[model samples]
Target: MAEKKEQPDASKDEPEQIVDPWRVVTTSEKGVDYDKLIRQFGSERIDDAMLKRFEEVTGHKPHRFLRRGIFFSHRELKNILDLYEAKKPFFLYTGRGPSSSSMHVGHLIPFIFTKWLQDVFDVPLVVQMTDDEKFLWRELETPDVARNLAYENAKDIISCGFHRDKTFIFSNIDYISSCAAFYKNMLKVEKLVTFNQVRGIFGFNESDAIGKISFPAIQATPSFSNSFPEIFGEAADVPCLIPCAIDQDPYFRMTRDVAPKLNYLKPALIHSTFFPALQGAQTKMSASDKTSSIFLTDTQEEIKNKINRYAYSGGGSTEAEHREKGGDCDVDISYQYLTFFLEDDDRLAKIKEEYSSGRMMTGELKRELVVVLQSLIGDIQEKRRAVTDDIRRHFMTPRKLNHKA
Candidate 1:
């Protein structure tokens, strides 16, 4: 059953006032309020019934992210499932902003789940590197910085085990210039959305540059089939499913609003919660801050030290007090990281039980996480070493994927 919220008063002059959610600013001390965000974003919660529907349609058990509610909210995901049941073709679209050379662990959530979706559905997947977006948003000395970052980030994504024949990755700086359809779709979106609408959606102010104001269209263009005519023919009615963090919903919401106007399907979405920083749930991991997260390139010793020294513990200050009071699995950083990377459901549950009951000390809990993360990162680093420039070029080249149906 979808959780319903009271309808906002229609009489209000500004409907955006209906519910205060993440616009331009995202701030949460304890963690994001999923329930409040569901109401505010006008999306449905991914309830048990929906999960059952998903399994029945896919003929496979849902990924852990769904089972554990890591991906907690969605917009029109049921419609995508229905399409899948009918054996209709739909493509996967997910992206990264090229702001850094190395990706933190938090960056892997969507790609991990997206890879699973592609494996099951046997559909083509497109990964967009928004170098233009990074250029507009950040202070860079030259365009080369954004371009180099896009390639570097692509290497990390390529390390995620995406099927080369079935995956097509593109940098906006290159692809935007090469693809006319992309430009047309972007212009269509640019025309439909006004300056005020973008201001309302993205919290843009007069001080912001016009490039920033128009960048949403660049992101939005990928939602339509025409944007990648080589993969989906110019007139193809193929739709897209976007799996991303909830922070990105505002951009896609605008895309969905304009899709129908251009005679395209509104992109379906599955939203994941923010991967909290080592310190707490109030903020997300930053690539600029080396100490705040575990990067894909970190050594085993680096992972160990970061988890032991920096991972915020939820246990009491003293051993005796911890034994009496127990640890908080809810706010514990180590436990939260396990929920994302640790695949064994039973093991994770047991860890939670032991830690919460004070049977395990804080050092022991962090040690467990350290081991799990080190192994995961070590494997990725090994794979990333093999992703050569030629491989990167092949992935970046726009072409038809070897999709089965």
Candidate 2:
């Protein structure tokens, strides 16, 4: 008989994971391999040594997100820490693109962590509302509609408890006109970067609009301190530490590349993992899809219903089978959400142990998550209701922030 030939395993040929500013997709039930992403994106992993150094430098325990590895990657973070140790000046920069009138709970991750950072470091913070980016990307009615969404979203952001004196939040449409220095830096970045450069960096093609091609420069301008001369006082060398999700890295990657050419300091970044959709870890939550996320505006009843009906369960199909095999917390959406919101470490650990051992049924695990989300969203709704037009204006205004930098 002839020698038998072995066929290759077809499962190994699964589609590549996709992660960018617009989308996140993965085939694995366990979610995107962040270690692969760190290697692909050329950013350093946040290890325990760095965390220890961070605590030593700041004299404060790291945020839950940091300790739990939710905020897992970084670029040039050590430089920012060194600046802080030397009593030198540095600020924070992070932003949001308003695609809808209301933000989902997933949208709160960066802001909640950034608020903690601002409190600990006592530094100035700048938040950009990218209304123009949304207008160009989404099928919105008009630029005015996008601008209105920005204002609505800003109210939610302000409710996160950022200090008005230390934080400056501005919409691109309004701020570009009011601030001359911001526009100047945008122009500087645009002049240096060619069509091919952005096309390669952002996956832009010939069919895309010129506005889309040029918008990266607007996002990049904030990395430089001189762009906010009123706040940083013409010192282009003053650095900034940006706390944002990993998907936002492409813009800052281009910003860092252009910094040396412009003689500006490169901004440091701390990247958080994506907030997975309710369905599963296969993708991120989308503002346009109501079923994919639990929005800030969702009622307590709605939250409970969503958790029961839609949140993906990693339990066995039958109660007897689940009890025999135990549940898998790795792919369970309810357990994943608790990791992000539930601050009590011991409680979370106990829940994990019980759920994984099949001692706690899926219903019980989800009920715990539902309670956490209900309380969190309820508190946010109350705070947002208190943010009047005047309060929003104060945060949006272009004024000197209260920071040594």
Candidate 3:
């Protein structure tokens, strides 16, 4: 019999047991069935027919390839599409609570999809970096850490090709200082929203600070374009829409409930499902947990090493077993991640077929993912490198935005 051929260890730096995918499987788990998750996430699946219908209905080719299931879940998206078709103006609002120096790959999903939406609709995009929220949560030195982190996060976002003329990026700490109009709107939101409502909406205990109760208002302020009157001017007549994950719905839900009473446009919403961490969907990724995600700053060599070492696989023991039995690609972390990055529709379909039917080995699947992701992240890192302090300051400066409107 031929000697059992051992593959070269892609994991050259680590110890033997650390690279095991089964390490994540402490007890045997019948992993997350994604089809069931689609229903649970409250977004309709976009099949090929739906994609064709979406284009016919909108009269524009989608800015994104909906084929890969990136924008998987949506609520009230078609209604908003109708509004866009009518040439009605609606601003895009989405935010991130800056808690760390660098965000993980999980962090980029919304921004990537949001960039596509901006290109598709040609609408204004307002990105809020919630430094205040981070200050309240972490034991940071007052607001400095949050501010610094927000600046870092903003650079990563600016790398996403957002049009500076149409996009306004704000850090709560910095923007709050000069934009008294923004705060005036925030105060209105604060008064209308009750402590009980916040407790119910955010799961805030009574022990939380007055600041904690107030932060939601800061988030809500952007939903109204007039908060930045310099940008929106008296055109408070223009309604707004927010595109963020469903976990954030409560803030907007509270806003929607209060907008009518306040006589503001009850901000329209488009909610997406939570981006699953590399480990799984049950919990969001933590920057504190280094192993839970692949970050943009990771090196090409590091990307390959990490996937080989940490990315979960669904292939069998022997190549013979893989060819005969086929691999289970449904829950494999590597294949699922590839769906997000790989752009070629036909190549992805073929890969899916081969992997699902066990024709392609897990190593092969991971190898393909590694190359594509390496290029994507490498390109991002290059753009990020070119973003100098001068460029960032221009983007971060509140006054630079065309507030004359």
Candidate 4:
């Protein structure tokens, strides 16, 4: 879920951008400067050559997210591709910190892309729901609240169409107790990572709880193949690829740094940009804020009302003025959302052209997005409704995933 951090003055030419696990904040209408972020994070850009290489190796077109540079930055992705090319085994790891009962549309980006990746690569995937992290961070009534939220969020993730045989979703609170290999890896990470190191990586201070200080190890454990003996057997050397939002890079950065010392393969990563809120690109959508985004549970009328009422418009004040001056798709929330959801490339391009040229009004552009989202969310709702407790349990169960490793 999105939270904004208080920052220095926005009047400056460059507002101080703050992106971390808990918050994503920027004052720019065009959102965070991802190129600057790529440099700051020391991650490589997913350039044209890389895309070409990916297509060549996988024999599948790069996902729309990759093609559009939505998942824009990466670390050691080529290593994973090379492993795939050589017919060696690798898996996927991604996670959610379950803070809310229902996840907003922004929460689906990684899972959607991960599903595509799973289909393309034919590999196993593990989704970690960090209920323990949420319990430490959030002011929930009890640990059970966070635990329940994890289960709820898993249904939404499962609704993204991950194959049951290829996907295993687990809650941190639940799995750490049951899996000895996972706990061993967590202990290994905790031992290698000092208090000073964690402070440097995660900005943990002496005032923070011991739980908060040590939680990075829990998140890092899934990156190692030996953590799940049922899935990968005793082969602790099998590397894994993590598909996650760039905000999560810090946890994995620490994991990667410690991998060699543990004699384990470093996890590879593919990073996605934050999905901007309906209110504007200046901040990400908050699951706690009903008006900030479209929730998976929102009705058709709510979707329409939210977009029409709250979606930040880049058009002129009046219809006549809009027609003359044109809308700015670059800053338009509706147009930005379409870039994520609308699948038809030609149609999206056409919409972009017409809207930016003043030929299309803000309402018209939003109407197009509303239809696309309603249908998309409608389909997801249908799928989510069919995801029973039993189905979710199967996805969460510790079993051998159906993949050649």
Report the Cα RMSD per candidate.
3.9, 6.2, 10.7, 3.7
Please provide TM-scores, in order, for all candidate models, with all chains considered together: 0.94, 0.96, 0.85, 0.96
User: 1-405 in candidate 4: lDDT tens per residue?
Assistant: 111122333445776688888789987888998877776778899999999999999999888899889999998899989999999888999999898999989999999999999999999999999999999988998988999999999999999999999999999989999999999989999998999988876788989999999999999999999899999988888889999999998898888888989888888899999999888998888877999999999999999999999999999999899899899988999999999999888999999899988999999999999999999899999999999999999999999999985
Give Cα distance to truth, residue 109, candidate 3, Å.
1.0
Candidate 3 lDDT over 1-405, as tens digits, reads 111113324344522221110111211223333344343333345567656766876677754435555554454556666777676767788888787888777778788878887877777788999999889877889798789999998999988888877788889999888888888888898888888878855767878887887888888889887787656775666677677655575566677767777778777665454444566544556777777788877888888888888776677778888888887766577877876777777887899899978878888898998998888888889989888878787777664353222
- Candidate 3 has an lDDT of 0.71
Error of 1 at 152 (Å): 0.6
Which of the two, 2 or 3, has more lDDT? 2
- Where in model 3 is the C-alpha error above 4 Å? 1-54, 63-65, 317-320, 399-405
Q: Which 10 consecutive positions of candidate 1 have the poorest summed lDDT? A: 15-24
**Candidate 4: misplaced stretches above 4 Å?**
1-13
Candidate 1, residues 8-120: lDDT per residue as tens digits?
A: 33443432222222322234445766776676678878999999999999998999999999999898898889889888889999999878899989999999999999998
Residue pairs that clash (backbone atoms under 3 angstroms), model 4: none
Clashes of each: 0, 0, 4, 0
Q: TM-score for candidate 2, please give it.
A: 0.96
State which candidate, 1 or 2, has the greater lDDT: 2
